[model samples]
Target: MGTKMIKSSQMNSWRRLDNSARIFPAASSVTTANVFRLSCVLREEVRPEALQQALSDVIHRFPAFNVRLRAGFFWYYFETNPNSPKVSREELYPCAPMNRRENEGFLFRVLYFGNRISLETYHALTDGTGALEFLKDLLCTYLTIVHPNIPLLSGWLDKPASPNAAVLEDGYNKIYKKARGFAPFTRRAYHLHGTPLPFTAIKVVHGVASTQKILAVAREHGVTVTAFLSSVLIWSIWQEELKGRPSWSPVAVSLPVNLRAIFDTNTALNFFECIGVGMQFNRSGITFEEILKVVSGQLAKELIKENLSQRNAYKVRLSRNPILRGFPLFIKNLVLRPSYRMGELTATTALSNLGRVELPKEYAAYAENFEFILSPTESNAIKCAVCSYGDRFTISFSSNIEQYHIQRAFFRYLTALGIELTLETNYFYDNKPVASPKGRKHKQ
Candidate 1:
């Protein structure tokens, strides 16, 4: 990706502005807490060079480097920005590798494996589903190249640049329009406090199961998996509110929805919108099933809402600042930070379901399962990345919040649904290693 250098002046001169340009909530998709997840099954002898090649290949296939937060708004064009700085992984973010440690940059390449690999991303670029699709393709390509013998399962596996193929569904542009986001909110960017909760990967092996089993479990009770999961999380937050001696009385849960379903586009910089769907509940009558029912109702409406698309968010953001394209980012950041915090109130925690990363039928033989890791945000808020691969489910929890109990209680409740879970943690002490994803004996 080249430097994004387009200034507000150059962009504003797009004379054919649509009169139908709409406004939406300032805290729309792109800026509303960036997050992403990557899951792959790696071989034991993965080398850095191999990973670099994999990443480079991945980028070349889908080049949306032109997408960025410039002049306080998101923009996408094949033409590289002449005004933007040359962005290396480290230079692109002001935060440290472990500050809010919030930024999700290029590959960490930390875990080279024995049938295991995982990575995370900042929400600034795209939503959970978007990231999952990219990773699925990346792994599929990497696997085919590395282990050509393993046949891939059937689904839309393909060479994306092909002119005659149905690419990954991205129906957002038809619904949302590009508008300057006048985010009237402020979060201490990458600033965090409180100790991170201790976490580890939980392990369990099982025979492959159909997506029907997973989806059946979710929709059996009339709630989509996304709604059911969010409901469970919201209930957990309320438990934290009551059981823990926290100052806040209510807990929150937030989620990101792909606006592509609402409209369509191909560029993958950042194109989804976010909404926090939570309720303050007393611990007295708390139950995940009950919350699930309620959330199903809310989510049904959210998914169908005409205005929850990217264009709506942009419109809302631009309505707040008509001249948003004219200011420097720091100046815009200064102007917009406070308003962001004000809008951050809808939820305290987030549950990101990357939905299903539909892989082809052939690859399942050796690829094993996939898992997505949720990263800690600059805010001390807790979040989770829920992803399903084959029959197994992986949930990655952010470690920034004060209560680890909420996460523990969350999984405990999930298992009650007849699904087994294994836990794995990803932090380390100075230089000394705690464990590797493949730290155990290789299965299969």
Candidate 2:
């Protein structure tokens, strides 16, 4: 949105992607864009014109987000793109592969339909936390334009003419520590196999529940929120495991940890790492309580600041080595792509919890709830994303596979525990009435 030319001195201000983000570009292809989406569903229909202006205004606030990915000799870096993101109707599905060439070289896009606005971005550009911040500001500006005299949330939206330099920094470098050793090689976890959907179609199923009830259940189990849900997911998959399959493989879940709280950096860039939690079930049959205990203890140990910090720092130190930096882009991709893909072998699926989202009471009237959707990978066919707004918490299950056995099992388990769940989907034919776990389908 800012048309003023960047000064000559600032022309070299293009920043490198953070350590965690460095692999996304090399891993990306026409089939796998490595993109994720954040959506804010509202009570009223969306106004395209006002949304466009709001996007332009918000882009000026978060300048780090206005970037296009460029391939250097050895790495992919972000260059500033002053052009505004095109706001159009929601024609494609959520988390669709993004072709940067179609959007003025920008790695992100904004789309709106009936009553929802979606922000889809290549993971190389930013993480869910940054994308949510941008969405909050955009919503604030759009509401202020459409409804005059709306009270704006001060702390929620960043309004400076330009983002702080710290917001553009590579936090991994700032906190890098020399490598003590390489990461332990994890044995391949069991993969969920199913008939792939035709034409790369992704089926999204959202199950909403009261946050209070869910947390209370977590308290009853004496496990953290993420641990409780993760255990349920593991149980779901374990229930669907085929009889005669290898029994040695463990059920693993990848939990993405946001590093901002640990590192004390506020960059609107990729700043997170994932650690896998897994357990094996015996013939005796594993109970939910046992699974919760395993997930809770594993999560507690892995989330320690020092552990994650040292691991992430080591990765940055290794990537920045002088010798490794000299590899050509093509060769780098050849080596990094398979390595990164193999990392997925450690987990059957991933669960990224964005946690709670807060907004001024005034903004609640315009917005309903927020949904965080994680993109599925070729190896990991299904992934889950979680976010809470007001009293409602939404868990979005996105998968390239057509079956919902895992999702259904997980939701049924929740309902059995007395947590009411309302189901919603993006699939066209799924609109017809279908039997649900409960007597009826609750409103979305």
The C-alpha TM-scores of every prediction are 0.67, 0.92
lDDT of 2 by residue, 286-344 (tens): 67688789889999988888788767766877787787789898998998899888888
lDDT for each candidate structure: 0.48, 0.81
Q: Residue 371 deviation, candidate 1, in Å?
A: 1.6
lDDT of 1 at 424: 51
lDDT of 1 by residue, 1-444 (tens): 543343444433322111111111222232233334465664344444555556555554443322223222432112222332121221111111321212232322223444555544444444456566566666666666777686654544454432211122223433445644333222322212345432322222112234555577787778787887777766665655454233233454557676555555543434556655655454456566666766777677666655464335564446345576576545555555655555454456666777665666665555656666554443435667666666666666655444356666777666677656666543332344334343443111
Question: How many collisions per candidate?
Answer: 63, 0
Which stretches of model 1 miss by more than 4 angstroms? 1-35, 65-114, 119-122, 148-174, 177-217, 244-249, 264-267, 286-289, 309-321, 378-380, 401-403, 427-444
Model 2 ranges off by over 4 Å: 1-12, 152-158, 179-185, 243-246, 428-431, 434-444
Error of 1 at 27 (Å): 12
